[model samples]
Target: MRSLTGFRITAQRSGVAIAGTAAALLLLTSCAGSGEPAQEAGAAVAEDCTPLHEFTTIEPGVLTVAAMNAAPKFHALSDSGPFTGIDATLIPEFAAENCLEVKFKPMTGAAAQLDLREGKSDMFGGLILKTPERAEVFAQTEGSILYETLGITSAKDAAYDTVDSLQGKRVGTLSGSYYVEPLKAAYGANNVEEYQSDANAFEDLKAGRIDAVAWQSIQGFNFTDRDDDYVTKILDDDQKYPELTVLLENNWPHTKGNSAMTAAIDDYYERAKADGTVARVLEENEIGEEAAELYVNGR
Candidate 1:
């Protein structure tokens, strides 16, 4: 099997289908020196756009982004329309704050980090978890949002909120997620099923192939909202299962060693929070107030 890191995919545009394999062609978009916000094809650029902070980007006045195509809750990459979702809007706001326009290149989660390391993109977007390993490789800003891993089960089944409840139960999770192994260890390896995507896991869960799907709380909310007879429960953190139970902070990953860029992003975060921009954005996306608090200060 080819490593996911080796596969290259292009940004989705009107009349384009997103590739799901390594056979996808790589297409790099060129930025104009216009210094205005980058938009989908045919979107007019304004006459004036000034940076609120002084920071360098990959291209002059363009914030090249390696966006996660799969994560619609945080940022949705559309085929023929403007970007939407929390990070989608937040990233543009940050770009404008730095006096740059956005130029997005949609790809998988792993590809985003690879692009950052190769200097192909200024930053990557999604509900990116903050980790020591990632921080060592990229300059990360303050927490843009909170991520609380939860257990999502069918309403027909008993709600699960404790580790004991999950023992021996068939639980599904994303293949490469941070909580995957921890969940397997806690619930027993034989009892855990890893799917390539959350959508697949949700499919299995609804079909009774699995007892529950363990993923971020936001996903659970989205699933239950779309599918009746489904419910979510916050798992209790017994300290031993903190990775699965703790509220984690998600942030943006920029090119490594870019202190000015990092500082500017951090500044943007502070200003966004203080002025209620972050709260307003989260609420507009239907994110819960508790999750919003995590963005303020993870509990």
Candidate 2:
């Protein structure tokens, strides 16, 4: 058995439904065509991709991408088709490069991974990252972004700063996130609480239900930047935590043994990296180099 290479991810927006009266069919069709291109956040002009010409995909000449709906990164509006974010926006480049049409499907985390395994989708990506075990089952590309854990607390309450300080209080983080175990280890299992989404965790924090919210640095920054009621803080300076960093890799996965598909993904990643596409996308999304440095270098 291979890595299964699939696990849970946090939600950005609720449901796969469009929020308004978007032209459902037209949007889907337009999203698949060449007329609507991916966001021009990357510097590279992707060259023609021909690997899929002979590759085995669920849909003939169409690249089926299984993704979750998340705002500012990927969105499948109520009926507006797929728009916004890295995965949704990158459809055109995949289509143009591979000489194929693109189709984006919204499904639960388990279902999405199942789609890739069953060949329902050519690939899938999101808050998903790669592990050594997963690599055995699915070939992966380099991570486009980095991830590190941090803590957030209410602005009115400055009682908590580090994990040790929250020993007697409740700490919140997204359920099924990689940070869960590490946080539990740092703050004690009895003190940890998990939420369905970032919004939920922050809601608890602002309401003073929890002493602090333990989460990835980006997540901590993302919400605090939006509402001044909360504040962001780091724990890398603490001596107790030495290896408190990881990169949240968003790699596309194909079925096991699909060497051609794997090669295509890796090749594109190299080109995309060299062209500054990765950096540009992160910048546009407000994931600055400074934040990434904090994760990698722990500065």
Candidate 3:
């Protein structure tokens, strides 16, 4: 027992020294000072911070944009096999800025909103109006992308002068559109004849089955260009149609989270508005003389 205490104390001191050395090594490694170059350590920290930059930037996959393909505003070509409109022009620019590829999907009738809600498309690019009900499912931009004036198209010799004047007349409108409510309220639901498409509605107006057709002024004017049988006049005169904007939902059914996508889109829209790309697209699509004014005034 004479030397047992000395041996035990020496072994305990050796064990404590080894533990402290291991702890020091760990601290040095954590501080990135384990004999590694400073630049390499900085790079490792940067790689960890910017995780999004690691993905392939080649295409960023496809962003499907839904359109009604209604001509002057939107149209899907059979030969081209896709849609084109003011939205078509602007979307590519927006996509380019965000490093994305775009694919256009043409839809008709009442399926436009359904396609977006069902996650069939990434965005809806036509002249969709903003409403409290619509906001429940979609996120809208702060300012309008463009302004469209709703008007009535009638036969050149028709006698209607005001919305009230068409109280008993048959008015053609595209079914399930925001315009339906106002037209039904103005002319009574019984007097309003609903059409599946604007093309058919314009056709009926030309055929004299309907006394007037309600449509966007610029779009209706463009339609009249294609067919000379009708004359277009502003319906409300004060240009009260809802402001058209690009639409994207808060959450798409296909994605688990859309915060990053929405942020990218918002940044793209802001930059486009600042650099005049948006205005150029509107002009190239022949929106109207009043488009720039309307956009600036937030109407």
Worst 10-residue lDDT window, candidate 3 = 18-27
Using alpha carbons, what is the TM-score of model 3? 0.67
Off by over 4 Å in 1: 1-48, 70-72, 75-82, 142-144, 147-156, 188-190, 294-299
Judged by whole-model lDDT over C-alpha atoms, candidate 2 comes out at 0.53
Q: How far is 46's C-alpha from truth in model 2 (Å)?
A: 15
In angstroms, the error of model 1 at 192 is: 3.5
**Regarding lDDT, does 1 or 3 come out ahead?**
1
The C-alpha stretches of model 3 lying farther than 4 A from their native spots are: 1-60, 79-82, 159-161, 236-263, 287-299
What overall lDDT goes with each candidate model? 0.61, 0.53, 0.49
Superior candidate under lDDT, 2 versus 3:
2
Best by lDDT: 1
TM-score of 1: 0.77
Better of 1 and 2 by lDDT: 1
What global local distance difference test value does model 1 have? 0.61
TM-score of each candidate? 0.77, 0.68, 0.67
Local lDDT at 44 for model 2: 26
Please write out the lDDT profile of model 2 over residues 97-175, one tens digit for every residue: 5555555675434456666666666676554555555566555655433334454544634735555666777888766
Query: Could you say which candidate leads in TM-score?
Result: 1
